[model samples]
Target: MHRTPTRRQIQAKLSTMPPQRSQATAYLNAYKMMLEKERLEEELDKLEVRRHQIQQRLAILNSQTIPEGDMTHQQANTNLEDNTPKFKTLTLEY
Candidate 1:
């Protein structure tokens, strides 16, 4: 005949186990690593958002004025001649 251990007996047995201590330590280390990774990712996201905001601000500051009516300056002009070499000529010569 075999007897089943009670809940208190099982708890007492678990308290003396070395493997349980090691398992707890491993779980703690894994949790710490996960937290550190999450913190770093959050920092990276903040930096990326700041960078995007700076880029938008810079674009607004560096905005150019567009001229109205019959002026080629507002549009890019490319030579359609196949034999002509590409040059860095401005659409409107100031």
Candidate 2:
């Protein structure tokens, strides 16, 4: 004759099952990594927005036209001279 397991016996058997230690550890690590990735992505997005704003400001400044009465020919010539590049030539004879 066989007897059915009582409530206490069933509870004891369930308690004896192995804990999912490795699986739990892996899940926690993955969750931390995901959070770090999200934070970095948000930081990158903020930097991109700042870059766009700076570029727009630069474009506006570059496109502004100087009034003819305000700029003198001598000043323009000075500006050109300052911006002109000086080149040196190196000749190699082998």
Candidate 3:
């Protein structure tokens, strides 16, 4: 986002700066970087929320087994039992 300098900022830089740093380029760059940092932190927060939702969905699916009347119930149950423990261990670790 390109931002035009506010009146206060321009006044502060033009009239109140010390002789050695008269240009104020460093201060302006620092402000820009601060804005960029805020944008990235917001993005990270959104990604974390999505990741948590996916993990919860995985846990719910892991807890279910095929019904007893299904043709492949035995095979499905064995697969679920084998994989569910791994998911549980990972869930606890996280």
Candidate 4:
């Protein structure tokens, strides 16, 4: 099976390359890393926005008053617990 090269193997290969080629390779890798960093930053911004939206939604839900009188606080709490929205777990990968 094919496998990724180790850091030592990569360094050895780079050392054998001409200086200009080595420098070009380094520059290309740095450019790619910068692109990746920007992409990750944008993703983080989107996630933060989504988090804030969810928090606002939760606050609105919490602020809503259950009708008072007929039911005791414990009963209202139980009803809220029973009706609470269920969320599926999500797995994220880089």
Candidate 5:
């Protein structure tokens, strides 16, 4: 029984071909471009994953409260101080 050649076998045959043939040059160029495209796609996938992680981290930070340790003593004291109005009320006669 005869079996069809695999993709790797076809690629091997193309690689060993002399550069003098225009058809071989085209095939080689195509092969190189395909490899480069695959590499770029993989890099894009990595960057997408990193972007998602950063977004998740941002969401988590937004949902949580700021710890006291992250604030200066003055800031902590200011927040703890009373925020009630201290201005005297002026009565205006109509």
Candidate 6:
């Protein structure tokens, strides 16, 4: 199976490379850096989306009105806990 290379492995390989062909090495390193940048940008996008979604949920929750009555704290807590929505989150791994 093909596995992704770790930053440490890439750095070690680059360090031990023969320094004469610097141009080729630079191009290859640039490509790897670009890939890493793209991956981070994608993660940032996912985080932005998740943030927006959470904000929307919070707005909805804040706008909700509760009936006024002599209710106990336990009942209100239960209602809040039961009605709150659970969301799936992004899992990032190298």
The top-ranked prediction according to TM-score is 5
Flag regions of model 4 displaced more than 4 Å.
Answer: 1-21, 65-94
User: Candidate 5, residue 90: CA error in Å?
Assistant: 46
Q: Write the per-residue lDDT of candidate 1 for residues 1-94, one digit (tens) a residue.
A: 8798665521211224354457878896677679777887999999999999999987776563223332454343433335576677668766
The residue pairs that clash in candidate 6, if any, are none
* Residue 19 error, candidate 2, Å: 17
Model 5 alpha-carbon drift over 4 Å, by segment: 1-21, 66-94
**Candidate 3 wrongly placed segments (more than 4 Å):** 1-23, 65-71, 74-94
1-94 per-residue lDDT for model 5 (tens digits): 9898766522322456556758977897888889877887999999999999999999888666355445666686886796777798999998
RMSD of 1: 19.6
- Candidate RMSDs in Å, in order, are 19.6, 22.9, 17.8, 18.6, 14.4, 19.0
* lDDT digits (tens) for residues 1-94 of candidate 6: 9898766533322456555667887898888889888887999999999999999998877666333233456688888889756786889999
lDDT measured at residue 21 in model 4 versus the true structure, 0 to 100:
54
Give lDDT per model, in order: 0.64, 0.72, 0.69, 0.73, 0.75, 0.74
Candidates in order, TM-scores: namely: 0.45, 0.48, 0.46, 0.49, 0.50, 0.49
Could you tell which candidate, 2 or 4, scores higher by TM-score? 4
Better of 1 and 3 by TM-score: 3
Sliding window of 10 residues with minimal summed lDDT for model 4: 8-17
**How would you encode candidate 3's per-residue C-alpha lDDT over 34-72 as one tens digit per residue?**
977788799999999999999998877765533434647
User: Which pairs clash in model 4?
Assistant: none
Candidate 3 TM-score, C-alpha based: 0.46
